[model samples]
Target: MNGSHETEIRELMKSYFDGLYHSSSDILRTVFHPDLAYVNGTTGNYEHLDFEEYMARIDARTPPASRGDVREEIIERIAFKGDRIGIVEARMTMMGRNYQDLLTIINTDDGWRVLTKVFSFVERKA
Candidate 1:
């Protein structure tokens, strides 16, 4: 399981974006934990909400149909002492925006589940 944690997290991330592309929140259910956190520039304000809060936002809002690449990255990877906890640094290109997201997840009894996902925009220098 130790060797596969990173791969598992990568798959979780892939599913996450794919979920958004299809607006199928069910796919999200497979990736996030009940108490996950999400942050992005779109909020205009920051929110530190749990899973329900996150899901409600997703449920309430509608994303353009596959407007951009999941453009998400696997920049850096680290496995914790328990090997069950992993932190990943990645970037995503969504709707023409470039994002750097920090994903924290745990390999739980069920499988790899994201505990938190925080993202901020990265401006490219001309």
Candidate 2:
């Protein structure tokens, strides 16, 4: 991947984490594709949500920052399959819980956008 292209992807990933930390749907809207489908399973059941559903959830919640949740993030890797495809692995703390996310990103005519997110809630040990 071109260095500039990689940089833009990194920036988009940063925005994603920041959006979760800040609970800013506007920021997330820019980073995720309109057709995004986010999947997660940790409560003994799987939950699937489209972009609008997830955004509405964000809109209803209190921002993690507002609740004094310290933001923590680790971007594990960003790998490219070609000019148009990239995969990102990352973890972040939000609302006092940890989440690991694998993002499928694609470069569209408009820009880089996250197409899908496969994630799980990480449980903290006592």
lDDT of each: 0.70, 0.89
Which runs in model 2 stand beyond 4 Å of their true positions?
none
Candidate number of the best lDDT:
2
TM-score of 1: 0.76
Off by over 4 Å in 1: 41-44, 66-78, 122-126
The local lDDT score (0 to 100) that residue 19 gets in candidate 1 is 70
Q: Model 1, range 2-85, lDDT digits (tens) per residue?
A: 657666676777887777656667888898887787766445656577788777777765664645444444455555557768
Best by TM-score: 2
For candidate 2, the 10 contiguous residues with the lowest summed lDDT are 117-126
lDDT of 2 by residue, 4-95 (tens): 88899989988998888888999999999999999996678589999999999999989988988778898899999988998999988776
